[model samples]
Target: MPVSRVASRFAGIEESPTYAILDLAAELRARGESILDLNGGEPDFDTPGHITAGGTQALGGGFTHYTPSRGLPALLEAIGDKLLKDNGLSVDPARQVIVTPSAKHALFLSVMTLLGPGDELLIPTPSWVSYPAMARLAGAEPVFAPLSTDNGFRLTRENLEERLTPRTRALLINNPNNPTGNVLTATEAEAVAEVARAHDLFVITDEIYEKVRFRGEHLSIAALPGMADRTLTVNGFSKGYAMTGWRLGYVAAPEDVSAQMLKVQQHTVGCAGSFVQRGGISALTGPQEPVEEMRAAYEARRDLLVEGLSGIPGFVCPSPDAALYAFCDIGGTRFADPAAFTTWLLREAKVAVTPGFAFGPGGERHVRLAFATDPKTLGEAVDRIKTAMERL
Candidate 1:
């Protein structure tokens, strides 16, 4: 009997490393083992009451039909206002916004629209794992651009220019970056915009973690002069509004690019859920106290985990400026790599964490611990890590 085979393009990529570790942690919990999870990146808080109430109201009002291929006009207008008021990026609701299932989907649609055979995308190292895979899925090659740790994981004009090729079609960056949680300074962001203009390249700025900052102000690269036309701004409700289960995200791009991306959206997943989008409208326009409360809680957890790990021998925990993660260096430890150390830590300490290599190069001998949990849990995980270090 002949068996069906998967496509050739998918053969090169594997599952997301973060979720794989999460599955292992789940299995341990099923077996009645006491496992501490520091691997998942989701916020522990629930969606606010007002937002859920909006969804309920929409359902009762018979808002279950499919919306416009782009999105509901009211939601689009609200997002446009949000981009202008909060991000300083002005966009047209009628032609520049498309609500999607998740931020990840918005990214995939953008990649497919901008990249094709023989095109290349510049992705900074230690980025979220999905960017490279999305590029490959669009039949484009992903080129890695190395960032300096001493420079606080920012992309300098020189390093970015060196990686540019004639085939380069676009550049992608995540502000308040994943894993490292380092926010780009105003000067650094201007340098990136300058490089993009000089090389005539498009930019995709993922500002999903913009609201999770602790010490720096969030600015959109698209707001810079001449960048609004060439940059695609991606944001959503998952991280900022604690509405991950609702799965709502959106992209603001130039009119033409938005049209192309709509074609992709029209064929797949058509439109974001009607009721969920109403919930998103409430999330954007309603009271923001819940968002602030969640941010404050994450900050406390971040401090607890980072402070506790600082005293562990051979471990160096940097103070993260934003996001719910702490990417620590384990280079001083005896382990050969982060994967080996993670395996040992899980078996001996009963704590699960994401290995650094999963992010990209420049992440060797490091691990990313998500602090999106309660303070007591984070404290316990820290103590367990200390004990595991003593054994090592």
Candidate 2:
């Protein structure tokens, strides 16, 4: 038989570091290793009771079929309401929103809607692993704009402009950033708006971790002046509501742009799950206490991780402002690349962490740890990491 090959579009792309680390950890666990799996960004909590009940009710009520390709009307309205109340953005539920299977799909749809082959997207370095991959999958080039660790890895005007080219079509910002867990302040968001407006670039802001902040407040770039029309806001129930398996996410954009996104979505996965949409509605409308409780627990876990890791000889980790991760710099250690160090930690200490280079070149000497687990486990993981480094 002739040799078989995949498409040329996948030439440089690789599996997401998050999932790769997770799979390795699972395999180790299956072999009975005492592994602390800190590579995943999923919330450790279960879906809230009210939301689960809503899904059950939808199942009992026979909502097993497909919903509108855009989404169920009630879920769309609930999403819009949540945006207005929480993020200060008012959107037309009918024309401006499309719920997809996951935030990852929403992002791919956004890229397909706004970009084409040869177009470039400006992405901050050490960002979520999926953003650049999504751009590549859309046949667009990802131009990484390195955000300085000195500035808390926050995006700035100069950095965005440095990567700007005529081929550049959009800017992708993951506020409450995935690996670093840094949130953009209002001032920083304005800088992004200014640059995007000047460059005439569309902005895709992934606010999936909007509800997981620890210090400063979360600011949406879409809420900035002159940015609403050009910004596509991507959010989901995965992190905030512990609905990772539910796979419910939505994008809010200008009417015309959203309509095009819906056209792309219509041809792709078609829509989000039917009954899951009902559960999403309940997640957005029910008492927000569980969200707050989960946030508090993560915050405590973050403190435990920071305190424990700080005492180690060569680990330098800043307190994450939001999200569930700590992107720690292991540059001072003997290991120049974090991949070897992380693998050694897994083998010797039975602790799993995501290597930083998988994010971008700027993350070469770092590792990312998700603090979504309880304080006890996080503390133990930190202790093990410290002891492992001592042996090095």
Candidate 3:
């Protein structure tokens, strides 16, 4: 029998390119191909022993039951203290924070809570692949405001002004952004905040990579005056604490919005894992030496990869100041399409990288190389990339 007709909301959505490449690499590796995977966004470091021990203690203490829809009070309090200490932002543990399965889930919750059919979300181009798709899933239109390579992919006040419309309901900002690794300055962030305030739009800021900055400090738009009430800040332990498998994230928003999001969470995920929440408590309260060590390693890899890629003919490699990615331009070269170039590199160089076209329209001529792998693997991948460029 034929299946029931699928919903129209899913018509425009497609598989995530990051995972698609990962699957392909896994298949090729199963066939004995020496694949060097640079397509991942996860850090290579293992979760800290203390964090793992905390999870173990929770399990042994028989704390596996369902938690409150919002989160454990202790975890929320820890997160509140962390926000104040790290980002200079204040949040009420009982009213403002809701722990979710992951930051990706937090984004979905924000969209569902604040958006609907007639609403619009203003997103910067060459952004994380899920932003527009998530907006579509929530029955909102996603309007693109393209950031230029000439501007280091940083959004400006003019960029925000040009994209504002009557239906614009929110603006999404990802600092130390994915794929592009662009971190906005405090001045630029305040300018964007000004536009959001003028348009009366909710600002959903993803600071998942806040701890991954290299050249300068990380700033939060939520900290700006008049923004705390309108901004929903989403972050988690995945990127910063090497806890991707833990699937722990949280959102801090105005009390009223946070209340509504708790209802959504009750019907949806119900709550993040209880034991995992315990581990998250430790992640927030524990010593941050592991975080710093991981960041230092990523910095070294970034330097090596950027320096190596810069030597390739017909390639333009920009030094990323934050995040663990090096987005390179491959236009005016032998390759014509980013997707095609990625496929060719995987087959010829046995190195896996993400195609830039998956990021957004403005990423068509570029590709993203992850520096989250080990130094030895990254060095080998660079050598292979150089050889591949020579072949082209």
Candidate 4:
């Protein structure tokens, strides 16, 4: 048999910058370099004890096997209940939800299922890096609609309208967005729903950071009037429950759309881990204090990092209201761009931060640093950065 050629879909898809930075940090750490990492997107806190216990109980009870292609029955019900309680969307779990190994996986499933060649997915700029790649891998074109700092990085209808074309088939929304941490306001959510309705476009809303918000109430586009039938809501236990390693997340969509997504889930990654699904049930239904505590900690860290970055001579940072990143504008800095600034910091300050261009358009002059770790460590990074700035 001839050796199989690599698929073209893999071309131009770089490793996620978050993971790439992590791998680089690991290699430096192995070589005895003290790298203060602020490049991760996961919570530094441990997974809540009760959720761990739930998985342990299931494992002990011999739940170590494949679940139904969609997900475990009870787990799906728990997710449905969570949607109603937290997101205000009523769903029939059996037909509307599919568990995947991670929120990223669920997103991949969605783009693969709904998009194809020549179709365009309108993504707000500075999005999580995987979104555009997911669309591309599915043979669709990703059209980035740049969200400006002038608008506080909010997704406006005007932005979407300008990007729309005959081939635009879907929109990917990340609320409490990753790099910017801009939570969608009620008005913006309505704008999204309005455009979605006007264009009859399928909507994929990534709400993984819902629990990590610091500002306004998190609203789901699916919960808005006329949006339930067209929106795919994606959430996971990674940021909120510190379950990144557990690799558990889910997508809830209309039954018809979910049915197609299930075919993708069924063929690729059969289901989330059986016992992991048990853990997810506990994550959704269990006490949410840990999630709150983590959010509070991140809020404090955001303030610290933002204040520090602002004081630095050439950096302008906005206080992010959600998620773990502080996107700082470094265009005024002496270094040419975010990449140069990040490289300088890593070499001189012994710290790691993500270059913002990895996140796509509108991130050209910035760098994103995660506030996911402890205050002391963050303080140290700030000091190191300050010192590095002074020495230069």
Q: What's the TM-score of every candidate structure? A: 0.97, 0.97, 0.97, 0.96
Q: Across residues 234-317, which tens digit of lDDT does each residue of candidate 1 receive?
A: 999999888889999999999999999999999999999999999999999999999999999999899999999999988889
Tens-place lDDT digits, model 4, residues 305-390:
89888999988898888889999888787876777778788878889999999999999888999999999999999999999999
Give stretches of model 3 more than 4 Å off.
1-4, 18-20
Alpha-carbon lDDT, every model: 0.90, 0.89, 0.90, 0.90
Sum up the clashes in candidate 3. 0
Q: Give the local distance difference test score of model 1.
A: 0.90
lDDT of each residue in 251-366, candidate 3, tens digit only = 99999999999898999999999999999998888989999999999999999999998888878989998998999999867897888888888989999999998888678889
Stretches > 4 Å off in candidate 2: 1-4, 18-27
Q: What is the alpha-carbon lDDT for the whole of candidate 2?
A: 0.89
Model 3 residue 249 lDDT score: 94
Q: Is candidate 1 or candidate 4 better by TM-score?
A: 1
Candidate 2 C-alpha error for residue 299, in Å? 0.4
Counting only residues 3 or more apart in sequence or on different chains, how many pairs clash (N, Cα, C under 3 Å) in candidate 1?
0
Off by over 4 Å in 1: 1-4
Model 3, position 287: C-alpha lDDT score? 89
Window of ten residues with lowest summed lDDT in model 3: 17-26
User: In model 2, what are the clashing residue pairs, if there are any?
Assistant: none
- Backbone clash pairs for candidate 3 read none
